[model samples]
Target chain A: MTTADARESTPSSKAPRTERGRKTLRKLLDAAAIEFGEKGFHEASITGITRRAGTALGSFYTYFDSKDEIFRALVDDLSGKVREAARDALQSELPALETERAALAGFLSFAREHKEIYRIIDECEFVDPQSFRHHYETTARRIHERLEEGMNRGELREGLGEAHAWAIMGMNVFLGLRYAVWSEEAAPEEVAELANSILRDGIAPRSSNKG
Target chain B: MTTADARESTPSSKAPRTERGRKTLRKLLDAAAIEFGEKGFHEASITGITRRAGTALGSFYTYFDSKDEIFRALVDDLSGKVREAARDALQSELPALETERAALAGFLSFAREHKEIYRIIDECEFVDPQSFRHHYETTARRIHERLEEGMNRGELREGLGEAHAWAIMGMNVFLGLRYAVWSEEAAPEEVAELANSILRDGIAPRSSNKG
Candidate 1:
């Protein structure tokens, strides 16, 4: 993620004014992800995060006030990164179903590289409940928007709504957990295609009545 | 759940011997769910569970040696209950897709009643990582087995396997999180049918080419 992304993660008052400050803020948040991801919320410390970032304690204080502050910020930062990863994956114009496939593939790839993301985001449920809710709500909203676009284009089924979006999000999240974080037996693209197939045609036998 | 289920949750040596003992054990576990669910693992205390159970501290010890032991048993007990809920929902023979719908509806109903369950299970990732992994892995395995059965019966598509099961599980789980735990905007059957529709026909437009 870039320093620009880092700026959005921090509270405006504490956000970096200089480019160097933004870099340090980004470093601290990235370090916080590793620290919290490895040691968990309670065991993770400001000193540990600073040490990992190779930044001074003063630098950490400039961006974040405490470990809780940094942990919350890290979750927000990671959420933004997740969105960026999917956005980057779909730079090309693709069919509606292919867009979902690309999005899942991007997520799985990101999860494989940053496995700690699961731990950090999961822990946010306890550490900062609001951020935890915000992450999923925002994600589901994005998926819902995509579904609406696909429907409007006469590509996806009509009457799709928030529930379908949540279902798709859940499928992507769990697939990443199983294949990307828990094990690497399946490649990201392979896992994504498998999921996309469900959205494309589902599991019902071809000859079965739609009813 | 029956006393037999409670018996399996605890260590064999610690298993309740008499009817009264089993009842007390179930009480303790039920109370522990509320304690952990409301206060979380770190903050939940043995006394809190015992108090919620309306049993003496000695009775709590009779079934569990420590808070950690009781918490672990609670996760196991809840996992079993989840299976029972799905199984109970399918008392009569159902088409493969209908079976999936019933299971999702049952889970949604169970989740709505035991809202604390998500917190407990999610917290297991931190308090007891093994049980957390065991919960999802076991659930996925059950789903995979069902998919295999459906394929053999010529119901679901032939290539359906573990990935499909995981996808369905993810869909049900996130739908539950959105509609059950977070808000009760939708009925359990209503939510379940929406997911079942996805599995039955997918999100592709009715006239869209399958490719």
Candidate 2:
């Protein structure tokens, strides 16, 4: 098909009910996420996304201005879910070590369940550079806040609260990229354990944070 | 031009034994890096790379196999230079802190100088997932070795050596992605400070560690 033909399929049917609109939008987004995840954003066509969703090309335009816009909406949707999952994961009354594990597990689980969304968000830099940074900074900030709460509760060590939080967040993201995106050999539990061991115990010799 | 045309232009020439070949390859890689960085692997084409490089189509294939191969070679080439630069940065009997800072600075400087490479490696999963992981793990292994050496010399904290090394490497990589790739406002030096703060003082509280 011509590029434009592939770019334009059928349009979404307009509905008066907000719920119907929401459902349509969700379907379109979900399809877009899968397509973007598989093909990369630039390679994905609007026609492909709509066809997958059983919608029209114009319908997608009704929801998003362009492929880039759809990609952004997808990232935002998934990021919100990840944030919520992280929050829920932190709700336990476990000690520092356990808390750390739970948080990592929470993130891993979120990544595992929403594989398409995960891929789309992780590779957002290719689709749109600015949005990637915005989302990354926002997520980092959320993780920092969580760690700050842990610090106040005497859960984390003193010297580098925010710094550690950032490092931990970075570790989690990289590890998730590995376990979720790259390899299927390492089970989620295994990945979580390795991450936890490295984070809580650290790489220092005989240096458990017995404090 | 077609996608194949876009990738073939810049990758054909051999490593410049002569100044002309050298200049041509340099120009081609530079141009390709920008295109690859902005458009990503799949979306970027041989024609685009060549056009930017101001080189011939046949010349592009002479230097590299395919676009995929060119990307792989690009990653390999960049990693070697980065490792060399990091090693050179530590050229001294300076105290632990100075050495660490110098090494970090050197790495950051290299990252700033090669922003396109940074984007390629970081966002490469979209193009070739396997190659990205392979390159990343290889780079991680090298960074680990450096940190291991530092620990042996008492240049860095002992214990959990590999883990700490990984964290440090992750820190540098993520920061580079943020400051150099995703971010427009944050300077590389400033990002380095954020990392430096972590190395000097870890995130866990001193009290917890002591205990």
What TM-score would chain B receive for each of the candidates shown? Answer: 0.95, 0.76
User: Global CA lDDT of candidate 1, please?
Assistant: 0.89
Model 1: colliding residue pairs: none
lDDT per residue as tens, model 1, B1-211: 3344423567778887799998898888898999999999989999998889899999988877888888888998999889999999999989888999999999999999999999999999998999899889889988999899888898898898788888989998899999999999999999999999899889998665343
lDDT of 2 by residue, B5-108 (tens): 21222234444457777677667667777888788777889889899898998877767667887776666556566767677887777655455566667777
| Alpha-carbon shift of residue A202 in model 1 (angstroms) | 0.9
**lDDT of all predictions:** 0.89, 0.66
lDDT of 2 by residue, A37-85 (tens): 7887668988989999998887777777788777776776666667677
TM-score of every candidate: 0.96, 0.75
DockQ score of candidate 2?
0.28
Q: Please give, for residues A117-140, the per-residue lDDT of candidate 1 as tens digits.
A: 999999999989988998899889
Total clashes, candidate 1? 0
| Model 1 chain A worst lDDT window (10 residues) | A1-10
